[model samples]
Target: MYADLWSFALSTYARPGCEAACLRLQAQGADVCLLLCGAWLEQRAVTVTAERIQALKHIARPWQTDVIEPLRRVRTQWRAMAQQDEDLAGLRERVKALELDAERQLLGRLEALAQTWPIGNAIDQLHWLEGLAAEDAANLDHDALQQLRVVVTNA
Candidate 1:
């Protein structure tokens, strides 16, 4: 397991099928950064609690909504136009970079918040993924969620 959340996220995301699974979850309204953090916490055997989940959401929601989402919207909006124009493509790429940096910052904040939480204390450590997932958990893609779980456990 990685010593840091960001490293863990990077490695986990690079696993085969993980990226697509993450994207699928994201499209379903789940916060990928939060899910990744939850995966890291799960790997470390951190106990999932309402307060902890709320705290993670408190930090993640605003950053994702105010910082990351706008950058993504801009980048996505420019995708087609950028494909037709080199200048727009350059600007879009920059926006994409900024979006990624913003996500990294959010991950850092999440790690700082969760780093003090003890690990290996949970009787059941499998809640992180579902707990950190979108509020509409019943509607989420179970297959994608399972894929992520398999990748994390196998790692």
Candidate 2:
């Protein structure tokens, strides 16, 4: 189990079905950074409380809205044009990289915020996820979320 957020994100995202699950959740307005943070916390057997979940989201929301989402929007918006324009494709690739960097920075911030939070005996694997994505969780693609939870818990 990886304790480092970035490393855990990289490895867990590379797992089969994990990327698709993440993208699905992302499209549903879930914060991927928080999802990865959830995975890391689960790896360490942290007990999730509603207050702690809100604290994590509070840290992630601003950066995601102000930084990562814009880069992602530009990158995604350029997809069709990028198919026909080499210059735009290059620019889109760079934007994609920037988006990744933005997420990395967000993860760093999340790690810092929870660095001193105590670990607990019980593992609330889905609580973190639900807290972050509660609205969509009600109508989520259950299989995909289950897949993500499996990856999150290393199950």
Query: What is the lDDT for 59 in model 2?
Result: 87
Tens digits of lDDT, candidate 2, 1-155: 66678888888889888999989888877777887788777667778888888898888888988999888889989999999999999999999999999988999899988777776566545566666664557776667667888876654
Which stretches of model 1 miss by more than 4 angstroms?
none
List lDDT for all candidates, in order.
0.94, 0.80
For candidate 2, list the clashing residue pairs, or say none. Answer: none
Q: Model 2 segments beyond 4 Å from truth?
A: 123-126
All candidates: CA RMSD in angstroms?
A: 0.8, 1.7
Error of 2 at 25 (Å): 1.2
36-90 in candidate 1: lDDT tens per residue? 9999999999999999999999999999999999999999989999999999999
The candidate that wins on lDDT is 1
